[model samples]
Target: MKDTQPADRGAAPTTPAPAVVTGKDAGRVAFAAFVGTALEWYDYFLFGTAAAIVFNTLYFTTFDPATATLAAFATFGVGFAARPIGAVVFGWLGDRIGRRPALLVTVVLIGVSTGLIGLLPGYASIGIAAPLLLVLLRLLQGTAVGGEWGGAVTLAVEHAPPGLRGRYAALPQVGSPVGTLLSSGAFALVLLLPKDDFESWGWRVPFLLAFPMMLVALYIRRRVEESPLFDELLKQDERAKIPALEVFRSAWRPLLVAMASALLGVGGFYLLTTFVISYGADTLGLSRGLMVNATLVAAVVEVGVILVVGRISERLGPGRVTLWGGLASAACAFPVFWLIDTRSPVAIVFSIAVGIAVLSVAYAVSGALLTELFPARLRYSGVALAYNLAGALTGFLPAAATALLKVSGNASWPVALLLVGLSLLTALGGFLGERMRVKDPVATG
Candidate 1:
């Protein structure tokens, strides 16, 4: 849907227009978004890493080894199932109240749930209740994260000068890699422990750290200014009464495009990292430590890719960069798995790093592209629903890969095919989204 001038809707403007944000304020907001998202993702990724390596044994001990791993992966997917609900709830809050308040609530929810996971008892200690509690906490995390990206992207992009929207949007996207680095690094360090100690308490250490990180994120997020566009909406009393409903009613096409644009970043990432970790360690007979370290290296590579690609997006446009990135990733899908199948430590790391780097080109620009797809009045709900819907649909990729591996007699080709399909879907999104982009009334800042 094309963006239109805000209608008066019979209410007279009450609040004076907010002062223009200085460059310094913009930088602060970007930093705050980065920090807040990084913390939230760190918590989320911790569960993924643990699901691959720890939870199968600890929480699903009643099942056989293979079934237990599948069960653990299922729990990981459970969080994704709850994300759309979070998106609707927080997206409404963001659209109705303010971006800053919605973000603050999300950070708190994610942090508390993650920390509680650290303290939770295992199946040995609590029987069936253990997995149940894990699922409940995961649902909370899903809800929090569902709300996190949209608000952060909306806030950052709204604050950016038109010419620099790509770079500003990429700043918060950096959090995914940063979060991966922190979570994977934490696991890498703790993996150095004896197997007994590592399984017993080491995994819990990283999760426990979420509490303090949340506090820091909260402090920073609270200080950041609200989105200028959202502020303008507030002054005009133009908030959508039911943003989720409105998005579906008038913005379904962009919503679908956004989901397609997001699938590879969400699905393909889990395939390359979370599922690959399980595949490498459990299936390929690779060292668990080696697999975790490979992801750590990939996380480092992704950070560089995002920074460089962000600047490139400013020149090439987000959609073109995203399209190119997706095509490249599709081309590399088979080779990535082939390299990992070699079972050499160097090859394993190289495979994951390269895979993530290519996919990251699209991911880095997604924030800018998604923001351009909807008007400020419905941006939060539309972006959150689209992105989180993709997340919910693909959250089961690791488990699906696990199942595919079994059905294919342990061949990696089926999984590679899955990545190729996801990449092409992403490419289609970038193509369509660019062609149908909504003009950003406030982007000129």
Candidate 2:
């Protein structure tokens, strides 16, 4: 597709001419994006929860407590490392063919990988082969996830009315917290089982549920129309020959801004939920249920935050909302840790919930901000690469935080500092993103 800049410089650069979608069509598209994303993330987050609570013992049984946990987390990080690979592959397909086809493939890939995880043998039965298979499946999950958010965000944003893109885009972002709630809730229920059963069979139920969830997501996704912008591109015969390469060659700056903006949402989330859950249970001697419950509550809070912020961003602008949210999260970093350090259940829950809420403010508008960074022809590749590259970089945060905790003699300072750094990076990205959209014709185009 010929890359064209918006003619009206006074208007919001990302706001294209309104698509012809009716209110019902827009809602259906947004809902489809939300459902498919939620299911994909459910599969993804289940692994994080399992790494903290189950994989260390079952898959890395030969190691010491600390080493085993680290190993499990390493495997958890492996999925993240594979995300960019998926991004490239699916991004290419989305840009070359259509967003709907790429999304259908990703959902199936994630569901199958996640369901197989439920059926796989652990180290007890399969020895080293168990962890190897676990890593392989995690890679597939990561790859699927890498392609998921970009397509979901692009489809929703492209389908939205000019002024309502933020709200429509935010709908897909809501899937993150929904996935968290479902995954954590499933784990909480399974945790109530007898110890042996919970370890052997109970833990697998959540992963197994992916089969049915996948079918539902697929059905919904199949009903949604292709992105209106992609349809325009098709009619115009404007598809990029190599979308990923084009992004790197011409849109590298926006890609960087997107990655920086996306880091806290990806990394900060893992730090709060995955790392904190392990820290609470293992280091502070808190009950696992307490930790999981805290995340469940936080997930609920995040859903509200995302919806509220999405609406606000439509007025204030997504970049400004992201900047404000990032700054707020940075300011809360120390207090969040201080509260967690108190070893009180109420304090822990409050800390986690409040932290997630603030971070979610930036996260909620990410789809709108990112989609605006690239023209429609390269939107999938650009958005997918930016978001998943950030995922690849920060996917190891939980494992890194665990090591930092041990290195700092269990002090929370290092971890808090890490949060501060990530929040600041996001703030910078938001600041630059808004300015770029205004001043850089390439990005706006």
Candidate 3:
């Protein structure tokens, strides 16, 4: 049979399709997505903070002092190495049974794994086993995040009303900044403890905090119904039984575009947010608390600007906004680091905040745009793989940038060029994806 599906197999249905969200239900969907994603991101950002500040000293001290830090960062990146498996496993479940169940599983996995990290014995206590167990936990965390992002995005994008998809979709992206704020705040407080206590036991507080937050997120998620689009899909018998298999077979074009579209945005953010912490603390001799505060400020700006860009995308189209945002990111690439070099508190916050703002423009609209790349039957698998594929690489971004800096005699130019290149790639992929969407009538909604 001819492929009657949207171009690149990514566009919305050509027909009027199904309308699953009403006014009240729409808000509920977005809120549920936000809460769940916030929990996941809290876990993610917490680990990143720990890796940058404490993990090397605590868990990987077998290596030379400098090597321990790199090892710690490498372990952090290793977490992403497991995400592709997660995308496949959870993606299959989401496509088959339901999005809600799959997402529920992801949250539980992340919460349990994260909490256990608090209880794990450090290298001083457990020797080789310490880092070994830490690696295992990070792998689990990566998998959970791998599954969480795509399913959470669906909850908002698929439920959105026409002309409002941009803003509604952006709601889930809000969770990252919220997560960043909470994680940084938690660590900032922990740092206030006496040095011995903070080193010995205080670092565990943030990881333990996930347990309670997870319960709250779980309760809210359980109450929220599954995606309206998936329900319509069920009624139509269009759900793919082996969506992971089908997506690879029929959706490679859109999948390629999706991967490219997600790459720079995800990687650049990690380089900016996570790696910046290490660079500021270890290289620049900046106070850890000060860098954390700067990152917190950036997160705050990200939240506000993401909301605004979501609205702007409603009129200008996500592709245009996203492309421009990428250009904006390229522009800020060197400035952000230059501000850090100056080590001026006010300038640091402005630089990082502006950097995050530019990043969010593409991020805020990514869910809607990526979702449009696949038909509903296989969307879970398609989006999951696409997003986590980016995760697979992005997780290593900080380590890569760190190594580049070291190799270049601590020059920031290599890192800056990497940022600019990734931004341009994002622009190119988004522009092409947008063109495909516009050519397909059903995807316009």
Candidate 4:
């Protein structure tokens, strides 16, 4: 159990009392963060998927196909570009104020931005301003997302029992699969509508629905206590005077490692989900609904792989699993492109499922792996900055890969080579990242 006694000014808070938060409290925190993140990402990814499949026709009708795609994805990248800024601003508040409050603010920001997108007038109704408005909203969404994960991960991991930190911390990451399920399900549900209606109104419904779920997430988050570790740090006056700066000066190496190692999971996953769906449909001529169904199967496989990989990390360590997952991605890249090109529904589903399964090894351990990268005072800042920047690097990956495919005319070959190159780099970094976890001082500190 953590020591609960408050420490003297400038001292780290005394560890909270043995309320080491074993069963129920731990579960509550994890569930709150996981569910909240699920809803948040559902809104965010829904937009990405929509941008990939629906936005060009809905908003950027004036540009040629290639140009429209670039514009659409650039807007999509806007959100990621906003993340590091959000992290610095929000991370300071979190370190200075508290995690729960930061979480509440981020969730509302995301919910409002996403819901507003549903109501925006398209290009047909309101020229030039349509895509411009979307880029603005995507920026807001990106900012909110920057703050969301740091708070969520801090809230869950800080309250977790000492030995089981990895398993408990893994809980929040479940949101990726959950959000993937809901977003794709909503897209699938609306696919039942006629093409005209689905494009006209159906897409809007999913974004709007995020509001009700956001309210629920807020209620759950409001009920949780601040991090016992952080509270103890505060009481002890051990807080860094400038945490974000401290992290940069003291722990830049780990931050870089975190960024590089993250590509195997986050970057890879986005390319697999949002970009692949767009590519399979637009370039390969697969039906929108069928492509969505294939993504759904992959999402299910992802959820299962997430759970299994989390367990595997507890035993073999995240770095090892992540290394292997990257290797798997490298090996599977050609096969994935081959399956997509086959145009057979079964082939598409099988390929996507295989890709996600490989990526899940990295996904399952990412939160915990990142958390281990820095000390408590700078953990949020360090993790948030690294995570968001990695996001920024690959933020445009889908768009870039799609364009590369279009330009090369051999879509499968170019895309496969790109994935393999990235996977190998990510795997090499993960292998080196193994050293970062040796006696994780962050949780204990």
Please tell me which predicted candidate would have the highest TM-score against the true structure. Answer: 1
lDDT of 4 by residue, 128-167 (tens): 8998899999999999999888778877877777666667
RMSD of each: 2.3, 4.3, 3.3, 3.4
Q: How close is candidate 4 to the true structure, as a TM-score?
A: 0.93
lDDT of 4 at 50: 92
Instruction: Using TM-score, rank the candidates from best to worst.
Output: 1, 2, 3, 4
Report the lDDT of model 4 for residue 416. Answer: 79
User: Where does candidate 4 stray beyond 4 Å?
Assistant: 1-21, 438-445
Candidate 3 per-residue lDDT over residues 103-155, each given as its tens digit: 89999999999999999999888799999999999999999988898898877
- The TM-score, computed over Cα atoms with residue i paired to residue i, of candidate 1 is 0.96
Q: Please provide, for model 2 over 1-445, each residue's C-alpha lDDT reduced to its tens digit, 9 standing for 90 to 100.
A: 2355322234222333323554558888999999999999899999999999999999999999999999999999999999999999999999889999999999999999999999999999989999999999999999999999999998998778667888999999999999999999999999999999999899999999999999999999999889877876676666777788878977899999999999999999999999999999999999999999999999999999999899999898889988998999999999999999999999999999999999999999999899887888789999999999999999999999999988999999999999999999999999988766521111112
RMSD from true fold, candidate 4: 3.4
Off by over 4 Å in 3: 1-19, 438-445
Q: How many residue pairs clash (N, CA or C atoms closer than 3 angstroms) in each of the candidate models, in the order given?
A: 0, 1, 3, 18
For candidate 1, which ten residues in a row score worst on lDDT?
13-22
Candidate number with the higher lDDT (3 or 4): 3
